[model samples]
Target: MSSRRLVVMRHAKAEQDGPTDFERPLASRGRRDAEAAGAWLASQGVAPDHALVSAALRTQQTWESVASGAGWTLSPDFDRGLYAAGPESALDIVRLVPDSASVLVVIGHNPTMAVLAQLLDDGSADAEVGASMAGDFPTSAVAVFSYDGAWADLGEGTARLEAFHVGRA
Candidate 1:
């Protein structure tokens, strides 16, 4: 069976002076970091067939930078629901993904992003990577998982945490 790849990433750093939290844009460092993240994913051979990104400005910008750095030409769906979605809600959105997409990427905000990575880990892979991820999920942190089942079948502890990376530029 051809396994599926799920790339879960937190939005890059953002300026704190936006008109509202949802409207905050990525800072200069965040853009560079996200681009670096994209390059890292590319190096790891992560070619996403689809991208689900939050409608928040920071996330959108992060997706753009990542795409540019990775040299990908795919467009992402801007989702307002993902903006404030917790890990469960985010997983719900992921479950709605089309099966044709063998590789999927989700860009969202914190707590949820970090927590979702932990929740999906099956603990059958690299323990050190899991430990590092458990410590902190800073800006541009990413967790890649390998799942043998369909997207609909994905759930807590169903996927193996393949890799963890933090992009810095």
Candidate 2:
């Protein structure tokens, strides 16, 4: 009953055929998707007390759209390590979140986000999330998990997947 919610969101759709993947900004569709996703989260009353975001342009742009649409005022922590981080790295970042925050959001890339969601999910709810882990996480996707303990105690099986949302149909 820690009341801590972890909202992990994959960055919005990014432009393709850029000079480099890291430099690619969010596409026009990405902005709309991000706005929709943020609005949806707001409707759920899932505003983040804190946010950790990747430093990539697409990720930053995605965060901007979501934060603006959600009316979020918390300053986000932009981390370079999150760009291509593995599941363990992502978990480490989550563990570092302050206990004072009732909710935290992480905006990052795929494969790692998908892996972290699968690893942390307890299967009590959202069976589809486990099955979907094998696939790639689309842009503006969110996986929400609730932990019974504090953020410092967050670990594998400590959380249960509360819900999952994807921007695309």
Best by TM-score: 1
TM-score versus the correct structure, for each prediction: 0.98, 0.91
Model 1 Cα shift for residue 73 (angstroms): 0.9
Q: Rate the local accuracy (lDDT) of all candidates.
A: 0.94, 0.84
* Candidate 2, 28-143: lDDT as tens digits: 99998998888878877897888999998899998898887778878899988899799999999888888888889999998888778878887787567655644667889888
lDDT score of residue 124 within candidate 1: 87
Per-residue lDDT over 11-76 for candidate 1, one digit per residue giving the tens place of the 0 to 100 score: 999998799999999999999999999999999999999999999999999999999889888999
**Alpha-carbon RMSD, candidate 2:** 2.0
Cα RMSD of predicted structure 1:
0.8
TM-score of 1: 0.98
